[model samples]
Target chain A: MNYNWNWGVLFEEQYLNWLISGFGWTISVALSAWCIAIVIGSLVGVGKTVPNKIVRGICATYVEIFRNVPLLVQMFIWYFAVPEMLPEDWGRWMKRDLPNPEFVTAVVALGLYTASRIAEQVRAGIETVPPGLSAAATAHGLSTAQTYRYVLLPISFRIIVPPLTSEFLTVFKNSSLALTIGLLELTAQSQQIAEYTFQGFEAFTAATVIYVCIALVATILMQVLEKYTRIPGYVGKEA
Target chain B: MTDFDFNVIWSSLPFLWQGLQLSLLLTLLSIIGGIVLGTLLALARLSGIAPLAIVAATYVNLIRSVPLILVIFWFYFLVPLALGRPIGGFYSALIAFVLFEAAYYSEIMRAGIQSVKRGQVHAGQSTGLSYWQIQRYVVLPQAFRNMVPILVTQGIILFQDTSLVFVVSLRDFMTASSIVARTEGRLVEMYLFAALVYFVICFSGSMLVRSLKSRMAT
Candidate 1:
């Protein structure tokens, strides 16, 4: 109860700058990883529904492996273990020559982890599409690939917008874990601020507020996207 | 380019087992605590009292909006400061996980509760049961049954998240692996072993949930 309460240290130039840079890194990491997640996740998701057993099996295995492991452990494996497992020259380059190795590793780790979850969402979204529509597309002389590309994917992606929004928000939150691998993202910067000023409460409170704000803005934007993408006369699972 | 060293992992089994036990303990304690607190929050939100519902909603939303790691840091500082002395890492982590997971569990509980039919409540009321009795004897059993698979899914996530205690230097499974990796100079082997263990446990847990879901559907 007697601890000193100093809020001023948060606005000081160095700490403020740290927070800003940290925010930038968080956005950078989340966005870059999300790009990776959405692209690969959509492919794997669609692949899971393909007729080829081997492709479906590979996609399922990817989801199982990636989703099962913790992101922190995966990050560690990428940051510390994978490099050593690579060829000597490649490993040395990754260790010493690769720029922003921590950031890159964090992105790849988080992206792959998030992808598995997104894949599940995408699969569910696709499955939610009424079976008759896919049949109609096929019955209309559409090739299997064309059926998916034109009919299945468009509808599935729209249906999944809501879940994808949550996943997008999750990417930002999980970006905080990048701190474990020495990426100076928002959480790490706040921890740094706390360390330098001993104002842990103020520092973390700021980080919490920033995170809440990011989540709020992201939610609102995604809601708008959801509204825009709503298929007329279509009732989803909730309905 | 060292050959795969099963010997290092075999020799470190005791230490690793100790860490895995701690991780499981944390997961168990947090799930129990979170579900209990979360049920209260869910009930408060569904209670139809405006202020109570708003307060519960705000708490759940705020907690859900932030990352679990930040909450862990917040309590790691706040608990010691508030108590006038430090509680050790395990207790602090436990407190944080309970509070954070409560928010998630609240949402799941809310869905489960709502999934119980309105007709059942009316049936209980016609039988002269009080509100609490209706909830206790009628709605809750079905809600809990419906929620079992999802609750297990959340527990699996909790188990994976327990590894985040590594930030606090807690010797959870991941942290223990890293320590042995450092000491033995076998980072690749140690980390791969850790990942494999986590995969086995979590994969099996998810598979169980899938089976439970199918059974429930039937």
Candidate 2:
């Protein structure tokens, strides 16, 4: 069989547009879900840190449910089953009232699943803030909440920045899973492009390059962020 | 008025059993293929040759960064388009899944190799064992023992990851559930049945890995 290589196929306009649009969808999912992850993970992390039995139990159960289940199954449940369980008008509202129900379900599923994992990271980060700082703040007569805001949180966020970057990469990679529910993310778009051009290698190689670039950019930005927050030898510079 | 009919489970027993057989075969074949390929890839990454190392690293990283669904799609959709050879769905899915699982396992094994003490190598050399023999005798046994837990954890994760095959429309447990749901119009029961299937296989695998880990530590 004489095989022809088609490296130049993606330079064509239609294929280029397919790649660009797929990325637009992927980045939107990553950013939207990142917002949700930050908020939800922080809350659950704080709850995990709380001394109260009920609060810790609630946080643990949340983590267990979201963490143990496969994200694809969670997406399936969110897209198909959860809507059916909603109140009649509510289900209709979710199905019809939302623009891009696929996007919403993808965002919610990816966000919730990733948030559980991040909650564990956040809890570890928050816990790593030296106990002395918060104790000192409380001794200085700050309220408990004030102690957390003034002393604990800032340190923890800085400590967690590198790991937080990793979580971001994972969320970005996992956003590809959304394509199964028919979100036109990078994976889905690459498939569609390949279908049209039969340039499978070119489309997939482009997608791989895109993912590597994102991960590389993330690593670079994370390094910059680490520098901005630098207190030399603060955590002994190991991380 | 509302109860899960155990009888629906009984009637659907044959279908679920079929899914179980397929799921077991898929997992087993992929695990075997993955173990062999992943171990080699792991060794390749640790090999002294620069180009070989780069190739191994790139394979793992590229495969890992993309979703397994996409990998499966490549085989399921594009193989026919790209190659004149027509591969059946199950074997195609099996091949893709094995490749995907190998990337992660190989990554884990690479870490395992690095974690072995450098002194063990020198010691083995001093004892007059050849380099290949050193790896077989001194390095691999220790690395494998140290990595048993992680290998098993990866196994469980890979087992869960097998569910991604549904994207390629393979009739694994998840797809079987959908089929049962369609024919019997019992979505809830079918899913519950599927979940149970997953739980039993994964839970047992976890326990075995745990126990094996404890045994190896001794």
Give the winner by DockQ. Answer: 1
Q: What docking class should model 2 receive?
A: acceptable
Q: Relative to the unseen true structure, what is the C-alpha lDDT of residue A96 in candidate 2, on a scale of 0 to 100?
A: 84
Error of 1 at A161 (Å): 0.3
Give fnat (model 2): 0.19
- For candidate 2, the per-residue lDDT at A45 reads 88
Candidate 2 Cα deviation (angstroms), residue A90 = 1.0
Question: Which RMSD does model 2 reach against the true structure?
Answer: 3.4
What stretches of model 2 exceed 4 Å from their correct place? A1-9, A127-152, A234-239, B1-10, B77-84, B192-218
Estimate every model's Cα lDDT from 0 to 1: 0.94, 0.80
**Per-prediction DockQ, in order?**
0.87, 0.33
Residue A131 CA displacement from its true place in model 1, Å: 1.1
Model 1 DockQ reads 0.87
* Residue A158 shift from truth in candidate 2, angstroms: 2.8
Candidate 1 per-residue lDDT, tens place, B1-218, comes to 55778799999999999999999999999999999999899989999999999999999999998988899889998999999999899999999999999999999999999999999999999999998999789988888899999999999999999999999899999999999999999999999999999999999999999999999899
